[model samples]
Target: MRVVHVASEVFPFSRSGGLGDVLGALPAQQARLGAQVTVVSPWYADITQAVREVWRGPLEVPGSVPLTDVRVGAFTEGGVQFLFVGLDAFDRPGLYFPDDVWRFTQFGRAVLPALEQVGVVPDVLHGHDWQAGLVVARARLAGLRAVFSVHNLQYQGRWNLMDGVGWTGLPDGVFTAEGLEFHGDVNLMKAGLVFASQVTTVSPTYAQEITTPEYGEGLDGLLIRLTHEGRLSGILNGLDQERWDPRTDADITPFGQLAGKAACGAALRAEFGLDDAPILATVSRLAEQKGMDLLIAALPELTRAWNVVVLGGGDPRLEAGLREWDAHPRVAFAQGMNEPLAHRIYAGADAFAMPSRFEPCGLSQMIAMRYGTLPVVRETGGLVDTVPHEVGFRFAGATPEALADACAAARLTFDDHAEWAARAQEAMSLDFSWDGPTREYLGLYARVLSGPLRPLVGLERA
Candidate 1:
């Protein structure tokens, strides 16, 4: 099968978050599984210099921008073709610019032509998140099958109706209640949710959560209808085991050797000037959605038993809040993204804390578990699916007290060396690899291919 993945980011070339990571690993895995895969993403200013030009032409953009210069650059890695689309609007410093609505609108418009220029007639166009949402509608109009995956529901690409409607060049009728319209705005996400052959989220629990009023982000009614129509699904995201493996990682002591994790832990404690206490580490963005505020509130109680190390930066207020703990004897806060430190923290920490208020599917917990570090997470989204009682600790409520309780439980297990070792071993042994999820995607694609194209209901071609 031929498959094309359209997204704003792809790892090793351009990445901002989990969507990039997923696009990086999933397509490669699919390629390994015998599907001819191609990933299309914007060629941002900071993209690696390694991507060479392969195709270039004038792209016929509809609506406002009638035509623009389009360049397609590519390289093959892990049997999958990586295609980068270049346009002046995307020649910015960041993967996501301030004018993202217009930038990705152009990106969405460029996808099909980019594919055509590269000679790829895909069986399925899998678009990720709101940034790539409009591609689904465009693909469908061309009679191609498309699957839209919602990585996070909260970030629907919304803009003023007049501006966004013109950029899409879709029929005026499509900007209505049954189409891309949402609360008097043009919601790009709604286009995918309403018109795609299938709609999927990152995890099973999240898929169910998004169809409810609590987590739906005001699209519950539409999601409910899609679920009933048998077009919505949840396939749990998987880890790229090779890149995250503890066995071959040169950053820390390899898993089975002498001193092993203990040596790494000792070194980490010394690096941070932390005292000899059980270490609890968190490698995450400091945001409320990640439950950072709750973690901060629980610090006074938590620091009594476990030394804490935080790596990552976001939300200046949250950053300031966490910095106050830097003076505490048992807490170490390292702001910003440090890849090497993250690997070390995963290997050395006794337990990893991911107290997310609502995580769709987190890669950090899985990475921590892979390094024989236990995960203490709130029971929501994929956290509920991956971290079972036997492998890690979990809490129900999204509160400081609940996170503390979970950590307290993990601390208890940490004190019992034998039991802790057993649990850590079990976690490392569990398979979070992409092999299973890749096969599941292939199956979904086959199903989509056999089914007829979903009608646009009230939508019309321009």
Candidate 2:
């Protein structure tokens, strides 16, 4: 099977969060499983780190709009094949740029002609998030099969009706609650859901969540209808084990050099400046969705027992909360994404915290588990899927008390080296690799091909 992925971000090239990690990991994993995959993403100025120029040509977008097509070489670390489509529109520094809707709309419409120049028409064009949502809508009119993956439903790309309608050139009938319209505006995510042959969320629980009013962000009714019509499915995202594995990682240095607990504990102390206190780390975007506020609320009680290190960046509230805290030797907050630092944090920390309010499929917990760091997570989404029952601590509620108690339990558990070692072994043994998810995706693809949804979709070149 041939699969083409169109998204705004792919890991190592453009990554703000888990979506980029997923885009980077899954495509390579799918390739290893015998599916030829090519991903088209924006070539940001900072993308110089991961992209090398490959092929260049003139391509038409938006069903006759022409744009310069600069194809760039992409390195796939795991098993996936990656190709960065560099466009003059993306020559600017910002990905969303001054006009986000216009930029992505142009990106969505431009993918077909770009792929044609690459000399391959995939059996399925997979769109991730609202960034590539318009691709499926364009594909539908052009006679091609399209699949849409919703990383987060709340982040639907909504724009003015005039701008969106003018960009796609689809009929006015396409803009409705059942179509692209949401609250009198054009919703990019809604269009993908309505037009794609298959609509999938990252987890089954999340898939169920989005069909309800609470998690749907007003699109639950439509999602419920889609599921009722047998169009929606869920597959948990997987981690790239090659990079996440503790045993072989160069980032951890001396700690990863020795596997069993004692050496790791010593090395971890030096890495995080928590040589005396038990270190508890949480690496995530400092946002409401991740429940960073809850983590902050629990900190006063937490500081009494364990050393805490937070690695993340987002809302100013989080930065303020971290900065405003009473400076203690046991607590430190490293704000932002530093890959080596992240790997070291995962390796060195005694425990990892992920008290997410609603995690679609968190990679941090899985990465932590792989590094043999026990996870204290809310029993939701991928956190539940990845963290083993015996390996880590879990709470049902998404509250400060729940998170605090989980951390307390983790701290107490950490004191017991024997039990921690046992759990660490178990956590390390858990398989959150891409192989399982990739096979599941392939099965979904085959099912879609056999089903009635196949012929209904179309793809047109610009």
Candidate 3:
């Protein structure tokens, strides 16, 4: 199988969330399974760290930015090929920007030809999120098979119709409501949902949730149609087990030994200047959606019993809310993306808390589990799918009270030495490996490319 993934992010190079992790792992695994895999992502500013060689550019891209002046580059590794589209529109710190329509629209137009230029005709063109929605549409125009994955439905990438129809070079009537148009604005997500040969999301429950207005972000009705037509699928994401493993990860050091957790907790407490107590750590984006507000609100109540470590920075106001608790003896806040610290936090903490108001497919919960730190998440999205009842705690509401109840349950569990250790062992034993999801993806690919369509069977539950 010749497969190409078009996305704005990938790991070890670029990432914002689980989208990058999923895109990176899925393709690499596909390559290992004997598929010829190529991943094309934007060469953002920090791409200087990547080992790449300048490739021939000036590749003509119709209806968008000319690749002629844009210098193309590429790097290959481990049986998979990586390509980067270097242009001012993509050369930025963040994966997204205000003018993303122009940026990725041109990128979508360039991807198919880029593959052809490299002497490969893909059997499947895979697109991730709204960033690659246009790529899926372009694949259909070229009469090729394409799969569009919706990592998050909330971010639809809506823009004006004038810019959409004018620059997209799409056929007439495509901008209508039945197509990519939604309430007079161009919805990039809809473009993929409507045109792709198959549509997939992260987990089965989330796929079901999205077809309802409650979780749909206004695109539920359309998704329901697609699901009924047997063109929609949900494959739960898997983690890079090698990177997150406790036995091999250097960062997991002292924590992996017998009685190491006690020393680990003490060291982390000293580093954060917090009181010695049962530690709850959150290495999550400081945002309302991650249930940061509930965590903050419940902190006064939670800190009274547990020492808490908060990491990751985002949304000034949310960070401020967490910072206000910094003076508390049991509360510590370390802002920003500290990868080493994150690994340590997972290893050191007694419980990893993620009271997300919504989650597509959370890698942190799985990452925390890999380190033998139990997860406490609100019962929603991927959280509903992954948090095994025997291993982690789950709460229903996005309220402080509900979250506090869950944390209390976790702390109680922690008090039981044998029980807690047993649960942690069970959590650690989970197979969140790329094996299952990759097989499902290949099955989906084969099904989409071949004869009569049917629902994918034997999907592994996270």
Candidate 4:
């Protein structure tokens, strides 16, 4: 079957966060499963690979419906196809800049012509996030079957009714409260929910959470409606083991110790310039959503015994504060994206911390688990699903105290060689592969295409 993944970002080319990680890994896995998977993304500046421009043709969208010529590029890596839609507007550093509505709408509308030109009409159009949701919706309207995955529903592409309706060429009725419109704006994410043959969230727990107002971000009612209509489902995301494995990782100095935690800790400390002080690391986009504020607030109390190394940059306030603290005797903050450094941190840190207030399905915690570093996480989203009670410590509440206490618990394991070793071995042995999710998706696609659930899938919830 042919499956086309539409998104604004793809890993190793244009990456902002876990969304890129998912796109980079999942398509390859789907290809391995015997499906022809292609990714459609915007051309960003950081993408250095040689991309061939395949077409420059006019596209017809809703409003202006002008057959304005759009540039198209084709690039393939790891057996997965990529279509980089080039707009003089989107060719800038940012994927969505001045007129984001026009940029994405044009990208969405232009995909059909591009696909037709390539002589490949996909069996399933799998769209991701809001940036690409309109493309899937437009594809569906163009008589293609589409599956929409909500990595996070909070970032709905919403615009004022006049501007959105004009750009999308959508009916004025779609600008209402219940349709593609929300609060007098046309919401691209909502349009995906309304038009997609099926809607999927990253995790089962998140699927349940988004139905409530707290995590829903004003789209809970819409999700609940979709749930009632039997169009919504949840599938947990998976880590790319090829990039995350400790044994073959090119970044970390010391290799894997399949059975001992003490030896691993010692090796890690030597590599990171920490002398036996329990090294705790965090790799995350420093944002309020990631609970970085709480992490910083808890640091004063945490610096008594442990050494902290932070990687990642976002939120100027958090970045600037971490930069100041980087000079501290025990704390180290790298302050930007360093993949090798991240792998080193995962290998070297005695414990990894992720205190997200709400995590849809974090790849870092799983990557940390692969490195045999115990994770100290807030119990939410995929963290709740992946981080077992025996593997590490969990904080029940989204408070500094809860996070601090979890860190303290992880530190205790770090201090006790035997306990930490056993936990590390257990985490390393666990499997968090894409095989399961890919199979689930295949079954879901078969059901949608055939007009009902297949007997082999047995949709009763695994």
Candidate 5:
């Protein structure tokens, strides 16, 4: 099977979050499984890290208004192919620029023509998030098979109706309440949700959660409708084990190098000047959605028994909370993403804290488990699917009390040496490999090819 993936971000080229990681690993993994995959993403101005494989075509995005020139290029490395949409439109600093909708609109429209230039029409075009949502809509309108993946529902690309309709030349009918319209604005994510042959989120539990009003981010009604029509589904995301394995990591002192987690933890504690208490670490964006507020609220009670370390940065209010908690001698907070430090922390920490309010197939908990660090997480989204009692500790709610209870359980378990060792070993053995999820995605693709939803309703001009 041939798959063309469209997204705003792909790691090593451009990235802001987990979406990039997924696209980076999954396409390569899928290729390894014998499916031909090519990903189309914007070529940002600051992307100087990757050398171009070949310059394919200096092509024009067909039927484009305010006619702009864009060069289509190819990049083949590590067994996966990449078709980069290169033009001044995307030649901007940072992951997000001033006119994002305009940039992605041009990007979405460029896929088919670029593919044509390369002489390959894929069996499926997979769109990720609102950034590439329009691609799925455009593909389906042109009667091509397409699949859409919703990484996060919170940031739907919304713009004025006139601007969106004019820039993309999308049919007027597609801007209605039943289409891409959200309130008074044109929502880009709606294109994928309403027009694709099938819509999928990162995890099955999140797929179920998004269909409800509680976790839907205001698109629950439509998602529920899609679910009822059998057009909505979920496939859990997987890990790139090559980079996450503790045994071979050069940055972190491996278990083989040190006697094990005990010696490693002692060294890390001494290195960070932290107390020798059982280490509980969190590595995530400090946002309310990640339940950072709950972690903060439970800090006083938690730090009394366990030493804490945190990595990642987001939201000023969250930073202030972390600063306030830093007053506690046992708690150490490190801001921003440090690949080496993260690996070391995961390897050294006794328990990993991921008290997320709503996680869409979180990879950190899985990574922590792989490094022999049992996770203490809320029973939400991928956390529940991946972390069971046999492997890690879990709580039922997003509240502070619930998180406190779970942490207490973790602390109690940590006090029991034999039990803790067994659980850590069990967690390390849990498989979150790409093989299973990749196979599931392939199956979904085959199913869609066998019976694709044609003439996707509510896309034509009224």
Candidate 6:
């Protein structure tokens, strides 16, 4: 089957978060599964400098503004073709900018033409997040099956109705209540939800959670209808096992050798000047959604018994809050993204803490578990699906006390070396690889292709 994945980011080339990681790993895995895959992403400044361009030409983009300079380029990697759409707007430093609504709309408009230019037609056009949302409708117009994946419900691409219509060159009628409209604004996420042949989220629990009022982010009614129509489902995200494997990772001691983990742990403790207490590490963005605030609040009680190491930076207020703990004897806070340190933390820490208020599907916990580090997470989203009690610690309620209780339970297990080792071994043994999720995606695509084509909503007259 021929498949095309449209997203704003892809790992190792350009990425801001999990969306990049997903696109990076999933398409490659799909190619390995005997499917021809193509990934379409913006050619940002950082990526332009790294890759040798294979193809480049002017792109046909719809809108009032004459986009004569818009171009598309291509490169091949890991058996998958990558097409990068370029515009002066995309030449900016970051993957996402303030004018993203206009930028991605243009990117989405270029996808089909770019594919045509490259002489590839896909059986399914898979779009990720709000950035690629507009592509789904365009794919349907081209008589192709389209699948839309919602990585997070909170970040719907919303803008003025007139602006969205103008940018997309879509009819004003498509901006109504049953279409892209959300509170009188044009929501690109809603466009995907309304137009796609199938809609999926990261995890099973999250799929269910998003259909409810609590986690729906004000789109529960629509999600509920989609669920009933049998057009919506969830497939859990998987780790790139080769990249995260403890047995062969070059960054840390290979697990095959005896005392490798222990030696690494000792070195980590020394690096942080931490005493020989159970080390709890977190490699995450410092944001309230990640439950960093709760971690901060629980620090006083937690530091009394365990040493904590934090690696990540976001939300200046949260950064300030965590920095205060830097002076504490048992706390080590390193702000900003450090890939090498993250790998070391995963290998050396006794347990990983991801007390997210709501996590769709977290890669960090999976990565931690791959290194035989038990995850202590709150019971929500994919955290509930991946981290069973046998493998790690879990707690309910998004409170400091709840996180502390889970950590306390983990501390108890840590004190019992044999028990901790057994649990860690179980976690390490569990499969979180991309093979299964890739198969599920292929199945979804087949189902979409076999099913009767539903009438396009919003874009057509009833």
- The top-ranked prediction according to TM-score is 1
How many residue pairs clash in all the candidates, one count each?
Answer: 0, 9, 1, 2, 0, 0
**Model 4 residue pairs with clashes:** 62-169, 63-169
Models sorted by lDDT, best on top: 1, 6, 5, 3, 4, 2
lDDT of 2 by residue, 136-224 (tens): 88787677888899998878888988677877666666766557878988889888988888899998888887887778889888898
- Taking all chains together, the TM-score of candidate 4 against the true structure is 0.93
Candidate 5: segments with Cα more than 4 A from true spot = 53-67, 256-259, 460-462
Runs in model 4 with CA error above 4 Å?
65-67, 96-99, 258-273, 452-462
Clashing pairs in 3: 58-68
TM-score of predicted model 3?
Answer: 0.94
Q: Candidates 1 and 3: which is better by TM-score?
A: 1
Task: Look at candidate 5 and tell me the lDDT of residue 128.
Answer: 96
Per-residue C-alpha lDDT of model 4 across residues 169-288, encoded as one tens digit per residue: 655544555567788778898878777889999988888888999999998988998899788999999888888888777765546675444555566566556655788889999998
RMSD of model 1 against the true structure: 1.3
The TM-score, computed over Cα atoms with residue i paired to residue i, of candidate 5 is 0.94
TM-score per candidate = 0.98, 0.91, 0.94, 0.93, 0.94, 0.97
Report the poorest 10 consecutive residues by lDDT, candidate 3.
453-462
Local distance difference test values of all predictions, in order? 0.89, 0.80, 0.82, 0.81, 0.84, 0.88
Those runs of model 3 whose alpha carbons end farther than 4 Å from true positions after fitting are 50-54, 64-67, 254-258, 452-462
Q: For residues 294-374, could you state the per-residue lDDT of candidate 6 as single tens digits?
A: 999999889878999999998999999889889998999999988888889999998999999899999999999888889
Candidate 5, which ten residues in sequence have the lowest lDDT sum?
59-68
Tell me the lDDT of candidate 4: 0.81
